[model samples]
Target chain A: MNKDRPDRTPESEERRAVLGKMASATFAGLMLSGVLAHAQDAAPQKTLIPARPFKVSSDANQDVLIRMQGELERAMQKPINERRWGMVIDMRKCIGCHSCTVGCVMENKLPPGVVYRPVIDEEKGTYPNVTRTFLPRPCMHCEDPPCTPACPVGATYKRADGIVVVDYDVCIGCRYCLTACPYQARTFDFGEHWTDNAAKGADGALALTAARAYQNPPNFEYGKHWERGEGIIPKSPVGNARKCTFCTHRLDQGMLPMCVSTCVGRATFFGDLNDPKSLVSELAGAPNASVLKPEAGTHPNVYYLN
Target chain B: MTRNTKILWALWIILALMGGIGIFERLTMGERLAAYTSYVPWGMWVAAYIYFIGLSAGAFLLSSLVYVFGVHKLERIAKLALFVAAITLVMSLLTIWFDLGHMERNYEVFTRPQFHSMMAWMVWLYSAYFALLLGELYYALRRDVKNLSPREIQEDDRKLKRLATIGIPLAIAFHGGVGALFGTVSSRPFWHSSIYPIMFLVGALLSGGALMTFIVSVIWPEKDEAWLDLLQFLGKIVLGFLLFDLLLEWAEYSIPLWYGVGPEADLVKFVLFGPFWYVHWIVHILFGVAIPVYLLTWKRDARSIGIASALVAVTFFAIRLNLVIPGLVTPELRGLEHAYVDPIGNRLSYHYIPSFFEWQVLMGVVALGLALFYFGQRYLPLMQTLNNREVSK
Candidate 1:
């Protein structure tokens, strides 16, 4: 029995040596492939200058905002047509605070009756079974936009980056686009101001003067500085069809849309769909992602995750 | 001037004054004083535009019966019909021009027209129609311009016939294009229909025929048996078109309401039984259709026909209002109206009633139409009787 044990021990040691060699070779092969795949994945990202460099988060998941902002910065490096702008709204995260709406208003300096984003609050079921849901509606920036063709003067058009923009100077204010939109996203600027009816404060103190100053600061839309003018002949935007431009002016400066940055619950995601690594693209690929009025065949860039 | 003529002049002057005030306000206030919101982008001005354009199309088509079809009975009033068409067309253009947000930029539709847009097509078609109308009018009145040889008169008549022939299709296309402007908007389910163009054409004929009949019965200089015969003929034409228009309207209303479900059904219900139900029931049906039908079929006298025709002509405005307003009143997206409220402008709401300023502008258009018609009838040879022409020959 002692002799048999000694012989088996040598054979077992040899077997262990063979197994160890095989395991080491397999581990080496895995490490090489992983490094190669990572290099392949990050080759395009190497050229991009992230607006905010990403750090390994201590949390299990990175904040979507940081990820989206990085994606946006990366997208800005690509050609305009190569970078298709898209948005995804996480309905579950929306708290119905309407900060995005307010943010859009302030960002665009929207007058009364002109809204770029509005949160639609709906109550479902009856009594004890009732549940409330909020939907933040923004311009879809449709691929096949009905509003674009409806303009008599070619005033409105869809850009290569999937953004629909209206040339305020060319718009005749016919409002045909307003009726043509199935989403009701477009609004006509009716030359209204908050200070139209404000009281005149003793000469130059408060109210009208202050309100005028606040309202007069030009909003940079489509990367153009536009001052809201007054008088018998109204200004361009005053009589133009206005809508959310996906914050193109902000995007031009390599910044995220006002609505995206203003989202308190991180419900809104904005990034380039062309870059598969984008947060919006990842979120938009989810099974729950859908568009409003899908039957309209507008092929909206905006997605909603229910 | 007779008392009626004096009264019309007084009425026109008052309307013109009221219109001036509205025009001044519209120019200065821009769209601030207008009640239409982005939700309901069009209102009374659009309705008035379609109404006047329809009248113009109908009048032009009636004139076609005289020139193109060679109907001797209608030839006597052909010039009058042409004049009415031209003047009403002017009124339509004026009202729509005023409705634009930038009235100055309206020329852009001509300059940089997008062919894909129905509104662009409408403007182009109407501009062509307007030019053709002027040519046709010039030819129709060419012989009246001066003493002409038999050959000259014959040539003028031939030219008039050719112009009128071309005008028949031009009028139909322009008027039909107007309907298509609304119909092609797939976003508005109420207006997105194949039947709209056909319905608009028929409505134009019915309303225009009625207006002409009323004018003939009331204003024709000679109240002879021949005049009565012409009035009776026009009455029959109006009645036929009236019944046909009602049928089309029934189809428009019934096809959607048959299922009693869907968005279209809801819109139809809104038109039939909504807050402005009286527009359909009382103004359009009772006064426009029912009374006219009764008078034309039973009474058949000049007086009864006159009243019936007058009612139809006037109440047709309500028909136009129904066509334009209901298509926009409902929100494109459910709960969209409540999504955002305008605190200062109050222009975000779906609710719209044409403000007094709007009515005043319409009154101005009406006054303009009346003044042009009156001056044309008085100064031009538009009312040269067939007997006078025969004697002159």
Candidate 2:
């Protein structure tokens, strides 16, 4: 019970702290190598074959046009900083497959009730004008998050890299922030598991990533820490609130979030918003791009193109 | 021994019966203790937590009038009310924790301490309040210990005075802090109102008076003139608090309602006339406030007033439900069909129902609180001096 100790050797406490730091660093290092390697091969190489493209602005005049031209030149010449994690969803392409939910579930090793992403099926109008739009919801990874302040223990927070993560070990399972969240984006870990082969879906690789961890290692970030073919699912911290981490572990390993890649309709886009050359930036600049619930003031990072 | 033992046996039986139902549910339908999801995440237990917290604050404040201010007539039931308040507050916190998905990780509140967390602030306030109330109780018992002729003070008497002495102000801070929690949430128009803690404080005092009045009548049926005079004075305070609470709520609602602020105003409508409409009008307004006040003042009859006070006590829980739930149930989105669906995907016809086990644990907790209060009063000389007759035969 004596947590503080001259009674205990200083070496013991020092060893424990060192071990904790090393464990965390090893995980981070693995993530860095995975991501950098993936980025090298996967990043699209482009030839800057010079072509003059004109973009129109309203109130084009001698002075206005000259000022706008100067602004455009400066914008094109600016150096790129850190990549901002972002997403673009094309409303036109969504087919309501629920594949995104499945991919998220598998990648994150979520519980039965805890889904990191869900597809909202919207049917428009009466019979004559009936139109259904599938809205896929991953964590918005809000720029101004509501869930952050509500966490009494700071168990949930946004990472400097723009990912929102939960500290599973520190979460007291008091779901106050869960209620405080406006998007209904959070899920409770009810100590659930896959009973039988019910969790087995069509994709073989997906099954491995999403396999139930019966005694789940405290995976605040997801990776296959559990050995393959163990058949025994380790339980995560069962009683805490959980949500999407914007695929942090996968991003570290130079991969697209499982959901974005597995989308049958290819409706989802993921990339650095800060990079001018990123495809997501181009799509987000389109006329129809919009974020969900702008009134919420949470300033969501996800954009949906209608 | 005969009557008291019989009462104790009856109380124990009641506790066991309620606990049995809780156990059955946890065993049988453990996975499905009524479900919730990200949308409609909170429910009855959260309300109940605030309810008991309110009661504790109310009771402690009443005791402070005696211990801190030395009001002689009110002193009779000050200790009794304080004892009930303490037990009730504990029951409240326990219910909410039991309802948590991550009950095991509850320690994170202390470990990480999101200084920004309103619930965390409330937790600290509640604990500090509990400590203060315990101290106040201890201090009140100083005279009792002095009268014990230096035989190391009776264990029961010593415990009460020592705890109450330190705990009185702490109890106030905890409950007042609970009020502050609701007031601080700038979102959720219903809860974000600045006057919320004041409302909570007033409500607690009103409910505390109501509870003590009922306890006296139930446990000791024969009412004397001295108790009746005290009862009348308490009734005035209760009704006055109720009047102030209504004014605050009405003014808070009117700001958005008059503006026709669509979804913002919609929450007020939910309480006033939507799904939970009846709770607002009937339980909070009618049975909770009107009938009790009417019986006390309009009737000007002590028996009727005591009966009304009992009515207020019995119905206070319903009032708490109205305060906590409706604001939470309102969807942040205006139109996401089933955006505000019961977390279990509307499998049950009712959006949210407190499950059988949930009820059992809750009932058991309530019974336990009452039992604690009863045993506490019996052992400690909390009652006013009457002829100095020996309580023990």
Candidate 3:
């Protein structure tokens, strides 16, 4: 094992203390049971110690990301259909920085006029009594999704894991699904570009070339490389109906969604709902947890903790 | 050609040329030039489509009066009406085809149709109706195809009658299905009503009958007493339907406006008093209904009736426009429009007005329809019986 560095932070000290407590507890249990007595006598210097890859905190709420990461890895071992993906956003912790929204756009390479998630800023009451609230709206990935049935070509459907996905290749871009969604989660890509109105080489070719280069890279959505094309007969996702997929491509790679990872206040949590110990399942089980437009009867998998 | 015919040709050419530029832009730019955003998904093209399809259904149903019900006074224009129906159906299909994001994949609706979707059902119904229309049109023209025995003529007439009987219900189903397409979208309260299918039928009859009356009064070759009498009969039918249609409109508008509280009420108020209020007040109420009602009731002459019918037929587009756009202007969730702003694309906005490109494409559709009508009238036996009557006279 590598030696502990001298330059230690308070968080590292807390983690080391937690680890030491766990080690002592395990040693006491093993001594009482006499399971490791023979091994301890043979190799007194080397006791069988458990491997702890993630930093442990004494307070359960302090290392939520680390806990959630562990849960995600455990859930990934299950079959795809058995794992029901879910999300929970704690609105009290959200500062409305819009970092999650920006992260989603960057992660998916969303074009202009198309968005997967947007935080709604609403002001309630009037004058002195007014209070502002932020509600981040993403695709509910409903159990009974209305948008899926509205697809005339059977292009959009709910996966076995409860994620609603659009088959970009099969989508006819009718925009019927856009109207069908009560939450207005779906948006059609009008095949627009950031540099559509920018002057060609106005400040020399550097800015224009860089912008083009940024747009040229293929986005890995649904585990497929999608290179956005220009002109009338646009590429698939450009004309297809798009919505949030809970970052399924990332989830498959044992990584959390971009929005969940980028949330500064740790407001967003994502994991398999089938696992009762998952962070999302725990948050969603709370009495304050609810969904937007419950009257729509969509039975959304995404929950918001008020 | 007459001076009127020459003027009509010049107008057609001008419209086609203007629309060509818009069509070119649409083909090259995709939906970039369209004013409709993700918020207001349907726009002028959708309205135009319903308008043209209503005309087709109405014209076909009018022809049913001649073939199925044996209304001999309407016999002279029955074939002409069928031709008009077929032409308008083509125009509606073309207009809607351009509205599709993947126009090439339209065949997928047939190959991989999801029956739960009303749009898929409507497309299937339209295909069935299109085939039935062709069959009916062929039988109606078979007697006039060349020299034929009297027995062959009688046999063709029987086939025509049978086809018309089949077509009447088919026309109602497809047109009513169009209304149901909007009606079944329970998300939009304005369109979610049982009355929509009936309203669409009434509107079709009024608009389609007016167009037929206008053609008979103004464009028919013969100007004898028989022609005048037929025009008067068509005028009375159109006027009755117009009044009935108004009563339905009143029911549609007033029932929701009485409370002025729900989502449907807000949409109704928006259609009446919104920024585009003139579309309903000046275009539809004034030109489409009031002026036509006044002329049809007061003057009663062939010239006056012709003008009235023309006004009603042309301004019915405003009625269609009101039906489609207002249902979509309001956001489903409050403040959702302000939540995400697409400054560069301007496609996240709730507000929508048909762009110049949209109107230009519509104008092109109308021009194409006019061209088709002209060619069909010139070459087909649409007016064979009427010409034979004139020759004998």
Ten contiguous residues minimizing lDDT sum, candidate 2 chain A: A226-235
Higher-ranked by DockQ: 2 or 3: 3
Which candidate has the top score in DockQ?
Answer: 3
Residues A1-306, candidate 2, lDDT per residue (tens digit)?
Answer: 677656667787768766665665567668665443333232222321212213322111122222223333333344423446778899898888888888777666665566767777777799898988888878888888878888888878887656788876577666766666666677776555543243455664555555544324434364535221111121334566788887767665545677876787768877767766556677888899999878778888799999
**Candidate 3 at B76: error in angstroms?**
1.1
In order, candidate lDDTs are: 0.88, 0.66, 0.86
Better of 1 and 2 by lDDT: 1
**What is the CAPRI rating of model 3's predicted complex?**
medium
In order, the TM-score of chain B in each prediction is 0.97, 0.83, 0.96
Per-residue lDDT of candidate 2, residues B190-214 (tens digit): 7777777667777788778778776
Off by over 4 Å in 2: A1-83, A193-221, A224-235, A285-287, B1-12, B20-35, B145-173, B183-189, B220-222, B259-261, B334-350, B386-393
Candidates' RMSD to native: 8.1, 16.4, 5.8
Stretches of model 3 off by over 4 angstroms after superposition: A1-62, A200-204, B1-6, B386-393
Two-chain DockQ for model 1 = 0.58
Model 3: per-residue Cα lDDT over A1-306, one tens digit each: 234776588888778766765576578656666434332232122322214423332123235676677787788888889999999999998888989999999999887888899998889999999988888888999998888988899999999989999998889888888888888899998888766654465674666676677777888999999987746677878778899999989888877789988888989998889988778898999999999889888899999999
Q: Cα RMSD (Å) between model 2 and the true structure?
A: 16.4
Off by over 4 Å in 1: A1-61, A200-205, A230-232, B1-6, B386-393
Clashes of 3: 0
lDDT of 1 by residue, A124-238 (tens): 8999999988999999998899999989999999998999999988998889999999999999899998787777446435787777887989989999989876456678788
